[model samples]
Target: MNPNEELCLCFHVTQRKVANYLRIENPRSASQLSDCYGAGTGCGWCRPFLKKMFDAHRAGITEADFPTSSDYAKSRSEYVKKGGGTPPPGATPVEDLPN
Candidate 1:
């Protein structure tokens, strides 16, 4: 193989690029990864393979095991406090937190 040929025809992502992202960023989820690396933003054709790589990067057996950006954001003390969960130790008002 030439090793530089694009794999995800939709996104023009390549295997080496994906591997580099896994090495450099250590992203937590496919969505987070997409935000940083633009993985699944095209025609959704590379989703399966991208998901597979993302899962492997996170040491997960499946993508479902990973957290969505919303999930992580919602699970934060800010959302929990809004949802009625007690603020965590050293918690600050959402407005006071850095934007």
Candidate 2:
């Protein structure tokens, strides 16, 4: 996903925001990412991604590739359909993804 794209859809947190947080704050743990505008605290879709990014940062990798925004959104739609998460009212609505 693009750096400006929303990684945490529920809270509208971007990858850039998280990355900057990681770089500037040098958080001691991945959980500290939750402190970045309530990133992983939302519908749970971005938690794994956040952890991976955090790990990458720890490993000295500056950037990690992600699926296209379209693909990622579609996957989140499926995840929500399967009851994997409950997006809050202000979240980016789960789109009715095409098969």
Candidate 3:
């Protein structure tokens, strides 16, 4: 198995684990995952791999489940707030955007 698969296997860390950390813990960036989950603290070797997992996890979410635009907007606003920018005008509200 690859290193990422190996870490995932050894830690039993799933895409869900990375996703939950991003969604619930709201890690603002890749470095934060290291602080939160020891995901990137090792020899600096697995950092990029961990980040890819996190990105993949976040990228896998869907937006159709949110019931309202306002709720979706709120989530989008939060993501942008964490992301350090105003959301683009064309940007879909949170629930609508790619995870």
| Candidate number achieving the greatest lDDT relative to the actual structure | 2
How would you encode candidate 2's per-residue C-alpha lDDT over 1-99 as one tens digit per residue?
899999999999999999999999999998999999999887798999999999999999999889999998888889998899999889999999666
Preferred candidate (TM-score higher): 1 or 2: 2
Deviation (Å) of 55 in candidate 3: 2.5
Better of 1 and 3 by TM-score: 1
Each model's TM-score, in the order given? Answer: 0.49, 0.95, 0.39
Comparing 2 and 3 by lDDT, which wins?
2
Give per-residue lDDT, candidate 1, residue 54. Answer: 77
For residue 86, what is the lDDT in candidate 2? Answer: 94
Candidate 1, 1-99: lDDT as tens digits: 122444344345565677677668777776655653455554444456567777776774322232343333333434444553443233322233343
Output the worst ten-in-a-row residue range by lDDT, candidate 1: 88-97
Rate residue 66 of model 3 by lDDT: 20
